[model samples]
Target: MNQKIKRTATKSVTGVLLSIIIFSFSGVHLPVLDSTADSYFKESITKAGVSYGVCRIINATVSVIKESSLEVEPAGIGLSLAIGQIVDPINDMVERLSNVLVMSITSLGVQELVYEISVTLVPSIMAVVLLLLSLLVWLENDRLVKVQNVLINILIIASIARFCLPISSIANQFLQEHFFEDKIVKANAELARGTVDLGQLNDVQLPKYDGIIGTIENGTSYLKQKTIDFKKAIEITIENNGLIIETLLRLTFLYLGIFIIQVLVLPLLIFWFMIKIVNILFTSAALTAV
Candidate 1:
């Protein structure tokens, strides 16, 4: 009991010293250190890129899908006409799929929002919380044990908030390097190739028609031929879908990994560390008592 009291007294003194230092620096400046903690600013920016990268990937995938559908629309007309009633349902289903895909793209925006807020504001908030907790601990409040426990918990949270961005970013880089880099690069290259091919398809010039009647006839011919060409262009787009799916799956995994690291894994790690510290203090106190 005497040793426990001494330990508590030591903690109170340490907390008082920290509170003084924090106050000396001013609370506003307190977070600046944490903001840049462990190359956090750079890593945070890099992490932000993941969401942007995913958005770009999804956009490319959508473009390929659009081109494919457009190209197939005209050339597939004969097939559509032959199928008659079946065409309407197929077209409707395709339209619905397109809509759903576009909607899913919004998830990329959600990732951006989440990463930005976490890296930018959360650490600073936690730093301020740490400073406030220090003040409470220093005062050696009536409920000293409760206040110390809360302070320790806040410290764990603050520490995680300080380091999670950089750690998760490193993990992200490792995953990309070891597992997904080549596949993602190839997928990007494929999208670039498809874009180039689309541009080339659009480059073919139409012939001029002489009279109004001739112009009308030529115009109708032009539309049909363009549709057929579009259909051909779209074939490549459809073929790229497999690659797109693979890239999306990989990107989704990266996103989930990032989320788990920041939201769950890091906090648990901090909690584990705090528990170990508490256990060590308790053990020391027990040994001192004996």
Candidate 2:
């Protein structure tokens, strides 16, 4: 009778060990798969937002330059001429880069993949099943098994929904820290300087043709025409600067959208689904007891 009892206890211990091994192996893989699958969503959001804002700025500058017509002080003509010469090609480069960044993000199919996997609730469902099956196999006491199963199911669901893919959060933090420090901060300082300098355009003195030249007015008319070109150039430059500010604003909004989706909306939806799963498991267990 003692030997018989020992054998039964040994069988239960073996079953429990087997269940733990299986649970550990399965549990480990779910988080890995989730992180791998969701990485593209994070990457695409960052790239698309930053690139889109840059492109908008370039496009606005090009449009302003093309449409502008005004007169300014004769001394400003050289500055205007230089800007006119360089802006078109720069615009083209920016436009091409923007198109490439956009296409690259779109081609990744992040939203579609995430949507499909989420709709199926594949990972969370698999976790629940694994927990229940493991408990049922390992536990000798029926009442203890039911309680363990419920606890394990809830725990697994919570872990998958809330704690899976902490790498996503880490990556986001890295992006914000590095991008702001290296790119945005310096760009903002330069923009401020440019803004101040542009605002001081009143300091430029127009050429005042003296007596003989003023009376003859041969090249005076030409100088006056050149002054008109200078004004248009100044207008275009100011417009371009405004576009830069607009671009920064747009980029900010894009970042905000990305933050909402990844940090808030996505996680909340996942958590809600997990709660639903827990409730269902509890209800089923209660009915089984009845």
Candidate 3:
């Protein structure tokens, strides 16, 4: 009894410390994302025959915009470059990239590890406690054990879901807010305004901006069409990124969740195994006394 009490106390203390650490550590990695995107930005903006990296990202982004109207999180800039999955789901390369990148690409990989584990500790320890308590009475009160186990499982699920779901949602929302949401709207509006301005330009004024002049002599049809096309392309780019970022964030969080479940399950299973042994031994001893 004394040993069990000590162990429980230790677990409680550890859980408290861990929860505090996680609370302090879960800052959003938003700022570094622009740095990550800058890697592609330079490539995309440069002259032709420049970096294939820009083309690669642009292609993916364009595709994404064509597919969805949802926003991209700013920090989820990684997702903007991401492509493939939903359109392809299992068969698509995007799905593979999204999953692969979750661990491989984000700063979240190394940094979030400690925090995620920390967040998981309380629920994990609590899970062990519940399981052990359930085990002791499990054989004697089968109905009670079953009910308690179900409740514990629910708590475990709820805890893990709460932990992961928010992280994923935040990542998705972040990308949407920063990169995709207003970007598409702004880009579309600009393209439309550019069209109207070009239309209103007296034939005399079209030659003022070289780029505009070049586009105009090519005629409004060509200029406006290209503008719309390019705008849509950029929009797609933003959309693709959102999806991939969301996926990566989701996958990243799920891994930690699985870890929490394992921690809870393994200890619970061990305790139950021990309980079975104790029940068996007690039954034998009682018979002998009889």
- Candidate 1 residues 1-290, lDDT tens each? 79867775676567566655544543232343333333433443454354445445445544444454445444344432322232233234334433433433343344345445555555455546555664564454578768767766666655554444444445445554676456545644654564444344334322333567866766677867865754564454345444444444454554455445544575457557666776787689889999
Listed in order, each prediction's TM-score against the native is: 0.49, 0.41, 0.25
- Candidate 3 stretches with Cα past 4 Å from truth are 1-217, 238-250, 275-290
- For model 1, what is the C-alpha lDDT against the true structure? 0.49
Alpha carbon lDDT of residue 286, candidate 3?
81
C-alpha lDDT of residue 81 in model 2: 54
Candidate 2 on 114-164: residue-level lDDT in tens? 444543454455445554554454446878777866756655664454443
lDDT (CA) for every model shown?
A: 0.49, 0.52, 0.41
Best by lDDT: 2
Report the Cα lDDT for residue 41, model 2.
57
Clashes of each: 2, 3, 22
Candidate 1 wrongly placed segments (more than 4 Å): 1-15, 22-189, 198-231
Of 1 and 3, the candidate ahead on TM-score is: 1
> Candidate 2: what lDDT?
0.52
Q: State the lDDT of candidate 3 residue by residue for 1-290, as single tens digits.
A: 79877766775566556545444433323254423333332321231112122224433543544244224323233333332232333124334433433433232333235334534454455545454543443234777667766655554553443244234434433453465445434433443333233222111111123464564577777556644654554455345445544433443343333233322343345445555665677589889999
